[model samples]
Target: MVKTSKTVGRCEEFTANDVEVLGKAPLYQGFFSMVKYRFRHRLFAGGWSEPVDREMFERGHAAAMLPYDPVRDCVVMIEQFRVGAYAAGCAPWQLEIVAGIIEPEEVSEEVVRREAVEEAGLEVGELHKITRYLSSSGGCSETLDVFVGIADSRKADGIHGLPEEGEDIRVRGLSREQAYQWVESGKIENAASIIALQWLQLNYRKLQEAAQDLPLP
Candidate 1:
């Protein structure tokens, strides 16, 4: 077993720089093609290195919002079908937080708010930045910016989605207790939703107290 160390010095002679792909091996062919690519890279730490030609898949950033209504003590989530899961021989449909890819000209918060409206048909107010991290760092370059959004989650009417985009999202509202139960019951399966809900559970009291101190809108 490799022992973990926090204070390990950087290796000068043996350095691993960013890996780059030169070509790809075809994996799947559908609406979107999935491929594994060949790569060439360079390593530089104490000294400079030459550029190595490589190939990689084009990827985008995504955003997810955990809609929470402080007054109502409820949360809103969306359900959708994930193609990647189906390809991996798992459940294709998944319950997830409101999320979308970040457009080239759009900001992260804007992406989250737009996704909330598109996926759930809800207008969000102030947004609390939760965390930003890579979703699957192994093969994908997609990163996720997650936020806890303030909204009237209790007022969610029903499922809402954009037909033009082939989206058939189902919007659902759940009380804090219900959300927690779903997490425990294995109903909430998506990573972002699970992480956001768990974070909310841990910080619920502090957030509630903070919300109480805010002025009425």
Candidate 2:
């Protein structure tokens, strides 16, 4: 008998056409909707899989931004109470990058810019895209478009949020090193914050040089 190992590669052999969505039905509809999908996909070595039923939470999409003041070597972060964290048995108050849901037909950059002001009381300068990622691909239909926006950290303090929306956000400025340290120490738990800070760590020098070319505001 001989044992063989499968080769793992960067790209997969399967595409959407390989899967069939038999039917979809709404399970719950509220602030965020839930739906049940019946689908089947191609198997790794051969034929199709058995019909599968999965429930997916549909929260739409969102945009998140980490406000970096390259001139001051600081990053602005927001702290707020999140019900999701509380429900998950973690600390309710989370330190996170500014974020907001993207409404229909709204540009990602515009959504981040608006969220920056509403959540952190800071007006971002130039926008540098970081990445777009799914929040939870397994069970949620929420993709987040993340960015590192040039901002003035000096103006990032104070509590700011829309009262009508029940948001009470506290803004703080942290040195870039301290922010990254939080990521390393698990003090920053959200994916968006972690991704943004890690990216800034990798691209700090280039971002600083780019900031030098902008006119003083």
Each model's total of backbone clashes: 6, 0
Best by TM-score: 2
- For all predictions, the C-alpha RMSD in Å is 6.3, 5.3
Candidate 1, 28-111: lDDT as tens digits = 665445666665444344322444433334467889989988887898887789887789776788878888888889998999
TM-score of 1: 0.76
TM-scores, all candidates, are: 0.76, 0.93
* Residue 190, candidate 1: alpha-carbon lDDT: 74
Measured on C-alpha atoms, candidate 2 has an lDDT of 0.90
TM-score, cand. 2 vs. native: 0.93
lDDT of 2 by residue, 146-201 (tens): 99999989898899999999999999899999999989999899999999999999
Candidate 1 stretches greater than 4 Å from native: 1-57, 215-217
Candidate 1 residue pairs in clash (backbone atoms < 3 Å): 21-39, 21-54, 21-55, 22-38, 22-55, 23-38
